[model samples]
Target: MTRRKLNMGKNNVYMKHWLSDKDRFADLINGSLYQGRQVFTAENMSVEDGEQGLVLRKTDGKEIAVQRYRDIMMKADDGTRIVVLACENQDEIHYAMPVREMLYDALSYVDQVNALRKNHRGKKDMKGWAEFLSGMKKMDLLSPVLNIVFYYGEDEWDGNLDLHGLLGLDRIDYRMLKKYVPNYRINLIDPKKLENLECFQTDLQIIFGMLKYRKNKEGMKNYVQNNRTFFAQVNQDTYNAVRAMLGSGQHLKTVNAKEGGTVNMCKALEDLYQDGVEEGIEKGLEKGIETGIIV
Candidate 1:
């Protein structure tokens, strides 16, 4: 098996660190994935370091050192029930994301099964090996693992959202094969597709709301102009992330340097709008002159 290096740029690195915070991570998951379920809390969440070692050996005796790292993994308890949660953050869309996510979930299940066998009281008995190895019965129930993909790309995700979607099958064949093939659907949280801003709480409301309008400069400007109070109350880290991700970092810095207070994104948006308008007019004028000369 060939090993691939995990390459992350400055923006992705910063985002990973930012999401590493338990509170912030929980807030995002609970708000977006759970939909106000409020089942997750910072106190209950714990980060799990991913697997690292020789995952496979080829027939040619070549060993492969592979690392599978998840962005976030934790167990959340709602007083009586506990569920395992894992999240993968993607800045870009992956076409084979469903398969990748399936692998992660499968690995987690394998680990859980191994742990069960190790802790079994009857391990010393001869029947223990048969029972554990045969996968006939289990002494304990495994917690359900929920895997989610948090996609933060500016453009819409065009990749397949489920295992079935990846299979190249005709409509008739797909219906026929449905019974034999197991389907796993990816839980994708895409900010660009979100419609209800009111569904979000805390910093996420602002983050997703801005992302929903990130491509529309005029829309963003209008949003900031109307919701000055909301923009003003944005935390510093979130402010920086939004401005940087939206290509307004320089403008934000200039405004902050001049005014020397809480960064007003509304003013920055106004400047960006004005700059865009001027640039458009200049291009239009140039095009008009060229057309006239040609005529």
Candidate 2:
């Protein structure tokens, strides 16, 4: 494969090496974003006009050119292409209502190009975001479908965001686009959950092993104190496997050597001591100096 490269910045200025990784991540993200459903096709990346250039083509031969200056492209597994446009930064509006106007110009040209090609393509929508609230009011949807993807993750997401209803398909202002374009579902991938799968697997497994080991040590110590015969009844292989399963040394000297479990016991005892002190103080105070005859 001739690694086809298109510069997303002026004069073919190369981005950091991580951009290649970001591009690959973009693919997986799109896949995961759409839940493994096809939603985008990516091609013709350029940035001469200020943003990268992208061609979003659908399986039916319909295509749209999304200027990358303000938008990003996501090619789906089923050959659907989604254009993600950012109009907001740091909880502030970046673009005004001019985005709806820009859509008119961009999509008008897309329609003209499609007409000339003797091929009509897939439905296209605009993904929009802004720091200030801009709307999809002025777009000429009669010419082409108009859909907007708005960035809703503002700085203070106090579970108080209503941008969805403002931009949802049911909104009266968005009725035109809903009537024309097939509304693609938008789902947020919790950034914490979307971290690398390997990181989650390894870190979680390590923590789990540590916890299991701690539990086994506590259980073994309890058994030794109470049912002393339990250890003698077990085979050598069983004993070793139990120790290995808990990620602990089998040697008697090493078992419970660190007193890690004892820390938990100590914490509980401290809580009990504090509780007893509080009760004793309260009980004496409730008597209200009765022994002194001051009541």
Candidate 3:
């Protein structure tokens, strides 16, 4: 297999690692996706390293390598029912996210079936063999999997959220294609679209609040200033994530988070200022040369 480095920058890396934490992952799922229907603890969640190898055949019968990985997976039980929850974190919008998520769910079901077949083979009894031969009539139990995509990008997701949308069908062709293609929709969590900040219990409340008003500098500043106590209480990871999300240039210089000590927000701002100044000088020089040419 060919090894390639992922180009996800520091912000994306930070977000991925932050979401990998059990508590944060569970909180995000519960607060955002399920809407507190299923309360999941960190103990119930597990990080599924995104590394699955599969080969696909093209129309020419040439095989190509494909690997799949989910950001996090969790097994949750609400006493009567059990479920497998898979989450994918995206810093940017993927046009084929719905199909990608559907594929992931399908692969998980396939894994379950394979595991059941292996278990059936392990049974040496005549009854087990008989049941296995009968298409595993006794092993009908399978956990339902729920796939969710958490989108944290600054802009609105313009991608197709439903599989059917990618079919390139016209209005007239919709009826014809209805029976042939299945529609799979993505459960997208966009912090920017969140209307109620109270729904979130953890630091996500503050985080989402900031995201909602990210475009308005004065609004974001007011939010951070008003929630001084909350910022002071938030852990280092959350603090850092908030800083990163707000852009490296904007951060709370006064608030010293307890977990990772003091974060220097001013230094990043200074660097940004220097960059802007240099860019302005370059632009000025270019404009001067253009004027000289015109003369």
Quote the positional error of residue 63 for candidate 2 in Å.
26
> How many residue pairs clash per model?
0, 24, 1
The 10-residue segment with the lowest total lDDT in model 1: 1-10
- Looking at model 1, residue 255 earns an lDDT score of 37
Pairs with steric clashes in candidate 1: none
TM-score for all predictions?
0.76, 0.26, 0.74
Q: Give candidate 2's root-mean-square deviation (CA, Å).
A: 19.7
Clashing pairs in 3: 50-69
The numbered model that scores best in lDDT is 1
Segments of candidate 3 deviating more than 4 angstroms: 1-7, 54-65, 125-138, 247-295
TM-score of 2: 0.26
Q: Pick the candidate with the highest TM-score.
A: 1
Ordered list by TM-score, greatest first: 1, 3, 2
List RMSD in Å for every model shown.
5.3, 19.7, 5.8
lDDT of 2: 0.33
Q: Please provide the root mean square deviation of candidate 3 (C-alpha atoms, Å).
A: 5.8
Question: What is candidate 1's lDDT per residue for 1-295, written digit by digit as tens?
Answer: 2221232354455466666677777777777766766767888776776562225689999987555777777777767777778877777789999999888887787777766666663464326567757443444678788888877765669999988889854477577887788988899987667666565566667667777567687788777877888776554456666654564322444333234346666666777788889999988889989989533
